[model samples]
Target: MMGFPQLSLVPLVGLQYLTHSSTLLSSPWPLASGLQQMGISQGDVVLLLLPNSIYYPIAFLGVLYLGAIVTSMNPLSSVAEIKKQIADTKACHAFTGPENADKLQALGIPAILVPENALSGSLKDIFSVFYKLIYSRCYLALRPVIKQRDTAAIMYSSGTTGVSKGVMITHRNFIATVAHFVRFEASQYEGSSLDNVYLAVLPLFHIYGLSLFVMGLLSLGSRVVVMKRFDVNEVIKAIDRYKVTHFPVVPPVLTALTKRANDSLAPHSLKSLKQVSCGAALLSMKTIEDFVQTFPHIDLIQGYGMTETTAVGTRGFNTEKLRKPSSIGLLAPNMQAKVVDWNTRSPLPPTSTGELWLHGPGIMKGYLNNAKATLSTIDEEGWLHTGDIVFFDEDGYLHLQDRLKDAIK
Candidate 1:
């Protein structure tokens, strides 16, 4: 890949403050050397419990460079929940934000807190031991020759249904997902450099943020502005300040944005935005209509995926097939999808509602350490039985019915 753009993280506190982003190429070796010295070997699982920050990406890449698995945890998770997950994953080392470090340490895990960016620009402000290693140069520390099938990440599913499960996403899974974005940008965004300013407000611990926004944007060398936390006013101001071109968000954020934009006293200044992608929870048709009516220039697209499908499975794309807010767009390239009856397990036709099953290279390796769950999720035929029930319109656009796990029989 070519050299990525010079990245700068615009802090939420002020528009003037900017933090330099250390790319995958130059920063990984030093950090990898440090990790090697710390006894982090290949295939060892490490937990990155952090909020959205420049340091999180660097630490994640460093672990991957050494052929180790990086399992990201929620920074806001309660102590009891964090303990259960750590024990479940068997991760001995954890890198966390300053806010969550103390709690993690109390649980007997080797937790390192990410340091503040002091004015001196010296290593004194950064994470003490971690920054020291970033300066260390060791040729032997580079161990990038990792098998594709090896587990690269253990992503925890958003437990909207019942219980949280750790999903094992492999290196090939990430590579395939990124490759799709690269190809899509090159072909669709022909005149443009495919490099635009990205608002990194989405939590990186989640697969939606990690696989697509973080990994995808970095691959293109786009500038990302990190928000410590999301506030409706702060987001609007950021868009106006950074001229954010693309925003991948959840449904709630969109709903809030629409409400704010409708306020006549404070008009929205989101002219630079080309598109806004939403998923996680189903967005109401009314919200989509209101947002579109308010900002006719912006393309509001919808998508559907899970922690199991890397990040993307079906997403709305360019051309005349646009503006279907109710639909989850189309199946991704090289992706096979089928809709089957809930009880009888018989295939359903287009326009008939049934469970959405998908087979693709983007499917996760499996649920980490849970073979029964994995087998039940992905059958012997390799099709992942997504609990979501959906149907297609006459135009072949997929629309949701409801999630079988949560739907009343």
Candidate 2:
């Protein structure tokens, strides 16, 4: 984390607020001890079917603390879908809520509920004694030989192109992606991190939100306003209530906001907002211009990446350099890329549209247990053929056009 702007830090905010950074950082250890007590072992896979909440991150880290891999799935996923993933990952335990607990129980999967509304008698009662001890000063130190290349998380692909394959993102991938944001990204996201409060409506299970908001924000020592789900009105209210400054959203939200009356939210509700990062789909120029025009002070940054790259490959990290319009800024540090002509399988020149291939530590270990698919995407030379048809301007901004798979048939 960088030396950030001054503030009495609010490290994490959820159904319960843990205002002190030290307490927030210390909370995970006792929880990790509790997890160990549950017979969770190293190299085992633990499923997290949780929403954005205080328990999510702590549980995520605790599993990793045991040298185990963490895989999170959408809580709203169909029961069959959830069952399929649990079998695929061979997850031994799960952290979920009551809404989805019956599905887990019906499947005979042992799941610990992460409750929100009531604390006294809800199913959370089973874990409340353990949960309360999470922030206890009593720290449990279990230092395993955790390597960066060890699989940190397995997030499923959105499956837009094919069946959802589990993407194996490692620990190093997280460090590399966030470091670029803090130190190098157009010098924009640094210094002011402490002053930033992120609206956590994006699903924490999605790599975009997990890496950028949960993991990245915590590493930066910033405040995160956790939301169980995305509600447009709730988002507006939270922004005003918490003085949220950094916004990470999908294209549809950006598009929806363009049609909202200027007065739908109070004039000054979003006055403290400084940046809005859009991804998960193509961001229309009209949407970007509309947001910029309406806010005047806020900068809209669009980025592109896949779950395999840990949700960051190219981003419009620089506030001033984004004037080029329809591009996803520059390649992250330690990353090499090329645009190769599909027909000849040869590299193409700048402005030549071809399949984008990227090589870096950010590349995942591969699709879990799917060696063939992994080999198909990542070549022997460590290049990940992104399958997205893209071109770079003379100034090196990436412009996405289409997916090579979609282009074929």
Candidate 2 per-residue lDDT, tens place, 329-377, comes to 7887788899999878799999999999988878888998889889988
Alpha carbon RMSD to native, model 1: 2.4
The clash count of every prediction, one per candidate, is 0, 0
Off by over 4 Å in 2: 1-20, 117-124, 129-142, 158-161, 181-183, 186-190, 318-322
Model 1 residue 405 lDDT score? 77
Candidate 1 stretches greater than 4 Å from native = 1-3, 15-24, 116-126, 141-144, 158-161, 181-186, 265-268, 318-322
Candidate 1, 1-409: lDDT as tens digits: 5435444445666644354444335666777777777888888889998887766667787778788889887788999988888888888798887788789779888876674332345546546666666656664444567998989988888423456889899988888777653345434654454457778778888987886555776777676767767888888888888888878889888888888888742445888888888877787778888888888888777877778888657787546544577788877777789999989999988899998898988888888778878888899999998888899877778898788976756
lDDT scores for all predictions?
0.76, 0.74
